[model samples]
Target chain A: MDSYQVGTNTPIKLKVGIETEAITMTYPFLYHSEDDDTPYSMISPFDPAQKPGWKQLDNGNKVNGKFFRVVSFLRFFNSFPDEETFNLAIQQVKDTYEASLKGGDVSPYMMAFELKSFYKDKTCVIESELLLT
Target chain B: MKKIVLLSVLWSSIVIAQSGTEPTAALQNIAPPSSPAFVLMDITPSNIIVPENIQAFSLQTISAFSGDSSNGLSNNNYAVEFQPYWYVKRERMDFFKYNNLTTQKADDSEVTPNDYTGYNIFGDVWKRFSVSMALMNGTFDVLPQAQSYVSVGARTRLLSFKTKSQINDIKSQYTAYTTFMSSPEVIAIFAKPGLSPSEINTAITNLETYKTIVTDFENTLQRKPVFALDVAAAYSHFMGDKNQDLDDAFGRFGVWASGDLAFYTPTIGTNSHVHIYGVFRYLRDGLNLNEASDLFIETKTDYGVKMELELDKLSFAYEYITRDADDNNEERSIGSIRYKINKSFTLNGGFGKNFKSDGEQVVLFGIQWGLDYEPSVVLGAGN
Candidate 1:
């Protein structure tokens, strides 16, 4: 998945195969450059009004001698009946990203994100962050 | 890869510990709505409406500080409710579709609140589903002495309807919040450099405009459905006295259904409603001790109605329930009031007459509060 590279202004599609029973929350943040030493800026698509189906992220901003990185917070309702199924779904997400990358249809950097889940407010939260350079 | 592996191991261990073992302290701290103990004690109102914003986990307790032990219980009772849907993993969920935020179009840019008419408050079955367990020690009129009992209950909303006007209010609030978020000042805060995530969050939360919009939006989200139907079932087991042979005996089993009709009264208050509720319950009670010191079962049916006036932070209600059985008939008449001090705390009081109590008056008071659990997670680390 890390072999392919994504160029500036490329459009990346984010997909999760698991069927959700409730609304999924998504928060997007953009980092200016690799060594900017500043906090990431929260981009468009505000809370409670942002459409959840906007999976295609247009990574159009580019500056010479600087690299842009995106980080998204995706929160989904925990509808799985058991942990095994949850683990399988996470694997499926990774697999889908890998498949998309290997098929040469999209750049590997497009799917350069890591998925992790942790306990929050007595609930489970799955967070994904961009791992691109 | 190592972090993922470590997380998997940690999650697996946590799951194993939680699957069937004794509940941990964190699990016990989860707040709940009215529990089986409250139902058995007839402390809960007959209305039984599901809360609009159900917490993932909640804990509710009836303490002895209320000073009105009219129900023959001197000890505190504790209950916990859990909604599994919030703790499990979910897949393929489209937020816009479930929340009525968009039309049935594939294009995201074209999605608008005008395209949607109503949002069902009880649309998601998972959000409505809840399991509650309670522990209480009390003396019942049918029993010889005080005993400890454990009760388990489950409740869910089966159907609901919402008015078009309520949806419109929500849409308008959503638009207002969107505009606020898009304002240049708000954008400048997010665009400012050197501000940490927590700093940014604090700034956003402290903004008066942001706070007002969020509070209004939340109140709009909390509007009651025009009508809703909910069903619940509960069972209790007596631990029995040490000198008695009735240990682990069945205490009570009941199944009930409740229907509510709510009218939004913006004239009285922006966050106000008038609710009429009807409830029916069937129960098999086995706590009665006969002349031979043996427990006996009685089949009973109860039907009740409640009328409530709900304001933004206060509510008053009156309920009447009549019980019918082969041997006797009794009625419960109660008036209750609740005051919400804040988001996490509430005070409740009730005054009335209880069923089959030989004209004994009933007075009950209690408090409900929730624990806020927030654990921080670092983001944007490479895998």
Candidate 2:
């Protein structure tokens, strides 16, 4: 196992790829950035990393990741077991985010995504996207 | 960016232009011959007098009818009308700022009354226009606030008689208006035990008088109509709340009466008519909130002219009102237009302005739909 320490000058890339099919993950979960030099709580979703690759466009189209920055990451048991359940969970998150967007101090740029090819014991990737209010 | 903006504007202009096609129906001579008449009803009040030909009880629906839309369609929002002889209505309607639809007036000092939710529950019975009775209990939020102040009000036609002429005009009528108001704090004190004998007696007397007025009004309807008169009374029942706001007590038992005279233009057929009226009211209010507990009395007069013109498919009304109330007097003018698309659908628009303030104006557009049930149609189907 390689133990790497991140610093303030170094940018972090949250790799969210599926090794298998039929897997769904909750996206835009609460994430706080941590570097080897900065305090763990120093980073917040309000002020995301303004790096270039943080807004990479794929396939000549703008993906959801381009508009938001990864705030925090957590791995847990799948809260949504099936496609229908995953849709329902994402809709609830969308509704909450839209409601908070009206008069919220922080930008409401939260989202969730799923991969059909991923399954079984694989950690569900939870990422919080930074919105440019 | 400039190309996009220009393109968007052009597209919008094109869309509007295309939507402005002339209506297929030809404009008929739909002007109503007379203005709309005001009728006080407990449930659904209709300015259009229902003829005796079709008096069968049917399922009735009333709605806020909107006027002509750019899309050539009418908008009707159905009102939740409860007309089960004795019922309650809770309505929340606001004044419309026509020119500046997006911006509200910056002057908070000039507040529009009747812009809050109202709850009214009343019991009424009528035998055509000959005899009618209503007893009402209602709460009104005169100011736009969280708590609603309450009032008790009643209205009755003491006597109404038709002249022997062919027009059968209403020769004379006597109406009595009574209202009693009190703050929640005063009401709380009355609710408590061990109140003074006089205080208790006053509350009981007020209730008894309310009952007497209603009963007497009903009883007098059997008599012939003579010189008509109007009696109005208002009072506040204060139950030993010395710390309450002074303005709250100003509403206490103010009583007044007036002589009312009305002249009507002959009915343009059976469905249309115009009425012109004037009223001189004398008011006396008890000002006990101050240390002096002085009685304040004054006379306020008002005059108004109303016209209701109704045709088979079109109807409209115009009103000019002037009132002298206390030191601050006000006059208002209002006009409304409604086009009945068919038997059950109508489009309406209204414009009103306060003559005292140039900037105070209101405009409204609405649509209405009515649904009635005919038992004969259903019962005769199998035959």
Candidate 3:
């Protein structure tokens, strides 16, 4: 992947519940990569279909808006059995994700994302990061 | 390992090849003609049938015809009487995945169990890990060597049908909870005392409507509520037949009732596959057959094994039938396995002999053709 050109050509997938609004889906590809040291392919909060403006780099040439990603931290967070237990679990995942970026593993290419769903008036906001290795 | 994989690939290719080709010419020759529609009850002649005939014949027939087997011979004596018997069985089981008790898709449709069209459309619910209601098919037959035969009886269940969209309402879906929570049964389980009658009536009404639609579609008569949302409603006076106008309503549908039938065939026939014990019935019937014989009990019995191979349906059954009276007991052993040629058709051949010393043993060869009815239960998903 290092040798391959990273541009708008990257393929990505969307994770959706059994039923969801089609238009608001977070799609693959529409993500912008944060760093070359990390992998791409992360779940992003911004719906790519809207084509949000990308952040400008110090050089400020618009960075061409190539890779954008989000990570599903659920794989790490759901292992805990309860909410009271999740505070530590969430910190652990965030710390692990941060360490991966510094270790040149996958964080350089990923970004954090959130999913908000309401059932029976119980609102749960799931915080997770998308990463590509 | 590679050869096994390659062989599997080759085998699959052969099966596909075979699946594509027309059945053997023998299939066409043995296939029963659709014209003699009443052939299911046509027990006048000794014959074997093929599966094609069984399928062609309607399931609505009340005939006592047995399906064909691969074996040619049958010593089943109960195939004579036309009386029908009833039986019931229960199978409730559970399902597990990765050892975690996770939420699963429940069969929440509100439909009756016997509605075939709905059954074919909705399929059985996999609620829990239970086969749910795997094989509750009812009724079977017995041999005539015994004066009295036995039949086990069981209850018939009705389904409460509800659509996927209905059962998975948006609120329930988003909540990751069961939409079927509204069911009368579930509501009762989690009911809070002091709820108003109107509030409770609404829930009971839902179950009532479900039962109405299901019975109209499957049964031949109306069924009063066996279980109701309101215990008061359930206990209220029985609602016997001022019943809703239904084309397919049943006479009556009760919960937890059972029935059985017993009869005998003067000569050997195919209904012998009905019971678990052969000698018990013979001894029981022998008491009736050898009455007024305290001094000298004269008796003759046949111990033989027969095979049936009419159609592809094969059976390897054994029978060591015996007859014992006040003074003497006679016994014999008979066993044979036969595979049917086509559906309902069998080519049976077997041998057996009396258990007595110097007993005459004879090889029996004959053809048995008849239809065997198989009942299947269709279930709905849980709420």
Candidate 4:
């Protein structure tokens, strides 16, 4: 509303877009489980084509771009069958340091994921250097 | 793969051109003053296609048109193709199925009626990785009485090369155009000196009237490229949850970018298009659109320079832009003419204009009555 001026005039109050990325490529609907959680049935994977470009000037420690992944299907259905179930699946595969994600969806994607459960280091990895909007 | 075999042979020739019942034969090749059916989640040459599960059913009639009579009418409550009537005006991008799934004191708390669908497709194994899981359901189908909404989106991409690719010497046809990149904070706010650089270049050339939307997003991000990106994570619920009356939820992002470079093609040896396309859409609802009276939010960021030349039946182009809602809005020039009007017709006309005059100044008339006729009519009429 009359304040966008990223020119020689500079003003530029708001309204600018172009940040892309934070999530690389993947597809492993390939399964391996223990009543499932081989990373949660691979949480729906099949991205025929993806690029993850733009959003440079990565300094400020990279910050934003990660959206929790369905609240870990609500803590993996709130822990269905556990005996320490790999330490509650290693606290649901670690990473997702909870910077600005208290709940689920509504513009949430700091794009985090870095869990490690023994027996094959249980992977969920999606911390692609975080820098997407 | 060849666009999934040309959309599965256009969905089996539109289901054998419909017979017994009236599935409407692919909505009669869509777009009779309202063609809307775009479902190609994402294709990048700068995010050239992220139509978002697109679903369209239309036949608008509130007693309109019919005056100068080019003829089209019916009686219905469905008015699709009003730029997709912002699709059901955003009921959280729509997806419903709630036959009672409550949860409270009975189990302490649960309401399984979330029927989430905020870009959730997560699973596309080998056609190359693509994952999805969107669940914002907040609201804002282009300001649908928008006072609140929330969104969360996720995306992925990779195709360095395998299954079909060749990197044409690392893409960049032209990137040498910067006269000291002027931006002394935007010429120090309309610099003084009796103010007159042609009235600030004819009022910023009125943002070059959008040069036909920068030649239709630079001719579909250079016809097609490889490895694309589009991330749309949004969360908005303006006015939050006031007594559940709600209207202030927020978080946002909508980005589309692209990159492609491949060469050597006698007729498909190894080819690539889509040099670079970077799109970004955002919204942060502090609400207060000046207390609403014409609440506005318009932003279509840009930075472009592209060229293509595909001979043999011909396909050529040129686009140059640095847009931000143009007033002379900077640049655009497209001149196209494709004519195959035979084997199922094809005749698209063109000519886009705008040099620097803030966005959308037009004229691009078009026609193709069934190109030789087989349910084909590729038009481009603009103004």
lDDT of 4 by residue, B1-383 (tens): 65345435533543343222232222222221211111111100111223221112222211111111122211111223211221222211100111011123222122222212122122111112222222222122223331323223333333222112211111111010011112232232123223233443333223333233323322322333333343333232333554444444333334433333433244531222323333333323233233443333334454554454444344444545454641223344444444443322333333444433244422222221211112222223330
Question: Which residue window of length 10 is worst by lDDT in model 2 chain B?
Answer: B33-42
The docking category that best describes candidate 2 is incorrect
What does DockQ give for each predicted structure? 0.18, 0.00, 0.01, 0.01
All candidates in order of TM-score, best leading: 1, 2, 3, 4
Model 3 over residues B152-174: C-alpha lDDT tens digits? 11111122233333223322321
Candidate 3 DockQ vs. native: 0.01
Top-DockQ candidate index: 1
- lDDT computed for candidate 3: 0.25
Candidate 1 lDDT, tens digit per residue, B1-383? 65345435544543453344332333222222465545765645333545445455655655332223444222446667676655554433344444533355454344566766546455656656888888766565556555777889888887777677776776787578667766877666545435554555566567899778766766776677788888888888887776777767888899888888999898999889999999898988887777898888888898999899999889999988889976888888888778776543456656567665666353354434343233111122331
**Count of clashes, each model:** 14, 37, 96, 103
Worst 10 residues of 3 chain B by lDDT: B228-237
For every model in order, the TM-score on chain A comes to 0.44, 0.24, 0.28, 0.20
Q: Candidate 2 residues B1-383, lDDT tens each?
A: 65345435544543454344433333221211111110111112222122111111222222211111222222121111112211111111111110001123232222222221121111111211111121211111111111111222222222232333311211111113111112232233233223343443344335654346434432332222222333333333222223332243333332222232323222443233333323332333232122354324433444555555655456666656565766556665666667778543445544564433365343233322222322111222223
Q: Interface RMSD values for the candidates, listed in order?
A: 7.7, 30.3, 24.4, 25.3
Sequence-dependent TM-score of model 1: 0.70
Report model 2's TM-score to 2 decimal places. 0.28
